[model samples]
Target: MTGTTDTRPVHDGHHTVGELVNQAGEQLSQLVRQELALAKEELTEKGRRAGRGGGMLGGAGAFAYAGLLGLAGTGVAALSLVLPLWAAALIVTAVLFAIAAVLAVTGRSQLRRATPPTPEVTIGSVKADVEEIRERAHR
Candidate 1:
């Protein structure tokens, strides 16, 4: 007989209960961390959208104020001289108001898009993960 022998433990595709339990715990921890990270990312994106919408709304307000100033100039021009000067100022004021209206509409749409800031996708993923874990646990 040859004097050489291999002395490695064979793997039988089975784990002890303690090892399984430990593995399950680690997996659960990892799943929770992943879910939290996903939630954080979703919330951060919503916050950025809200900020942009708010800034646009602020710009609309500023434009509206400028429109008010232009209307005041139109009034002064109308009182001082003929229709041409006042008509030009009125046209400028109308353009300013139109721009403000456009900005207001755009900002409102952006705000609507950012509404209901919840981690909906992450919530659904976590619910699915729970169901899967439950089914496996039963098995």
Candidate 2:
């Protein structure tokens, strides 16, 4: 025979069901770890967005308070340029409100993008792994 052979029994040299089961357990553990990581990342991103949005909302509240003071000619009149106090106050109020609107909108959109924190890809992969294991077990 041109081919060389290692004279070993097939079952002794090859993998067995016990080994496969152990490997499957290891793989399952790894998959769970990966899924947990994904969930953590997702929640972290969402939490950051929520924090930024809340901060922007707080900023909007502050600006609105300042606007009220501007109208009352108490806080913003000194900061006015060549324009009259009321006109400058109105202009500052409008600009502050516009910036708040933009921040609020941008923050809201970021928050919306991270609604559910489930690891969808990992879930699907686990389901498929279960199905494959079931099929192989049947054989």
Candidate 3:
């Protein structure tokens, strides 16, 4: 077998300068289409993940609210069992209001700590892909 392969340029119908330019343009168009499709898929996946995260957070908030209400009800019932009607009612209302305020603060803290749906990974990936394509095109 020969060590060096044939180096002669083969003419496969697209031999003219215009034809070569047209071919390159077509390939570039295809590359853009494929990249757009990939971006769409990535965005769709990211959107779904964000939606699920939001739903889970909402469910957690609802559960916490229910728990706070239950605790407040228990406190009112226990106090009413031993004290005068009006005094017990006042005390229970005060305790329940305090509990509610605490829960509100806690909920606000949780929300503040929650991670935002920034699509960081997806955007980074797309930026890398765009840079790569730009480099390849320049070459």
Candidate 4:
């Protein structure tokens, strides 16, 4: 047969069965190496995106802290009209603390979600391919 594939070099139909098996082994080895590379690339891209998002979250937290400080100052100024200065400042401090607590909990949840960046989809695809190959070999 004319078996001159880009990957396999089986010329003139003179290759023995053992030689063909050896070629198959070589192709399988190459396929495995390429698949591993794809998995690594996919996982790396996912991790990079998650890391960027986490940095944005940190930036948000910082800006929120600054804004909260400004708002607390404004609240104390407004409330000081009806109460003593210390009581108004205390009220504003309590409210600001509550907001900070909420944001800290939410940030923790997001950070937990961004961890353990594995290529799950690629792993499943590779498993399916391996099973298909096994089935065909059985036939």
Candidate 5:
């Protein structure tokens, strides 16, 4: 028998170089698409959560304002029992303004704690992959 190896096509045929490259390209494309879809999903979820949080904050602020108004009304009612009606109203107004200022400061701090929108890991990874593809293409 000849001492030569059989490099021909076998029962399970080997892919050509072109076929292998095409398969790789297709896989890479699929991976990138999946990553992008995941990123979009994450961003949408985060946006929804942020929206809900903002709505809750707004509701809280409205409730606080209403409470302050109620307090002022009570103050006016109390002062009216012992002083002139107009003087009582003015005092109530001043007290309400002070409460409003305090609430404004607190609301501002809560808003400051809110985080800005940002890309998550999926987006970052996709970007890295794109950069790598571009670099490889250039080379």
Candidate 6:
């Protein structure tokens, strides 16, 4: 027989077992880091959107308070004189209420979009990575 010695089972040429293990470890580490970064980015975006939505809601509350004050003014004007002044106050109050309604609707929509705040894209990517790793392991 030739003087060559073969101890390892068949493998793809060139890379030894230790090299393959090390490469796999490095790749796994990189994948984990990337996934964490993606999750952080996704959460940060969601938080910003949520903050904007909350701010709009707070503005709605302020407008609603202003509408209440206008309504109080309407009552005072109505008691003072039956015509003109109270009507104008009523109109202003209606306008303030309308603005509040619009702000509430827009804020609610923004909040809905931000709900279920999870790193969905990162989750899907990680799931796909797990499946790929499983397939490769089986092979």
Model 5, which residues run further than 4 Å from truth? 1-17, 105-114, 124-139
Estimate candidate 4's RMSD in Å. 5.9
| C-alpha lDDT of all candidate models, in order | 0.84, 0.77, 0.79, 0.88, 0.86, 0.86
Residue-level lDDT of model 2, residues 1-139, one tens digit each, is 7999987557856787788889989987987787678767766887799899999999998998788666646535665657777787787778778978999999999998975656566677668877987898799
Instruction: State the displacement of the C-alpha of residue 94, model 6, in Å, after optimal TM-score superposition.
Output: 20
TM-score of each predicted structure versus truth: 0.59, 0.47, 0.53, 0.72, 0.59, 0.60
lDDT of 1 at 56: 100
RMSD of 2: 9.1
Query: What lDDT is reached at residue 133 by model 3?
Result: 70
Candidate 4 clash figure, as a count: 0
What ranges in model 1 sit over 4 Å off? Answer: 1-11, 68-116
- Evaluated with TM-score, which candidate comes out highest? 4
Would you list the rank order by lDDT, best first? Answer: 4, 6, 5, 1, 3, 2
Instruction: At residue 96, give the lDDT of candidate 1.
Output: 70
Number of clashes recorded per candidate: 0, 0, 0, 0, 0, 0
Candidate 5 lDDT over 6-121, as tens digits, reads 87666467888888899978989899789978888888998899899999999998998799779878889999999999999998888777967998999899999987776677
Give the lowest summed-lDDT range of ten residues in model 5.
7-16
Q: Given candidate 5, what's the lDDT at residue 55?
A: 100
Better of 3 and 5 by lDDT: 5
Clashes of 6: 0
Candidate 4 per-residue lDDT over residues 10-40, each given as its tens digit: 5787887888799879988987898899899
Candidate 2 residue pairs in backbone clash: none
Cand. 2 Cα-lDDT:
0.77
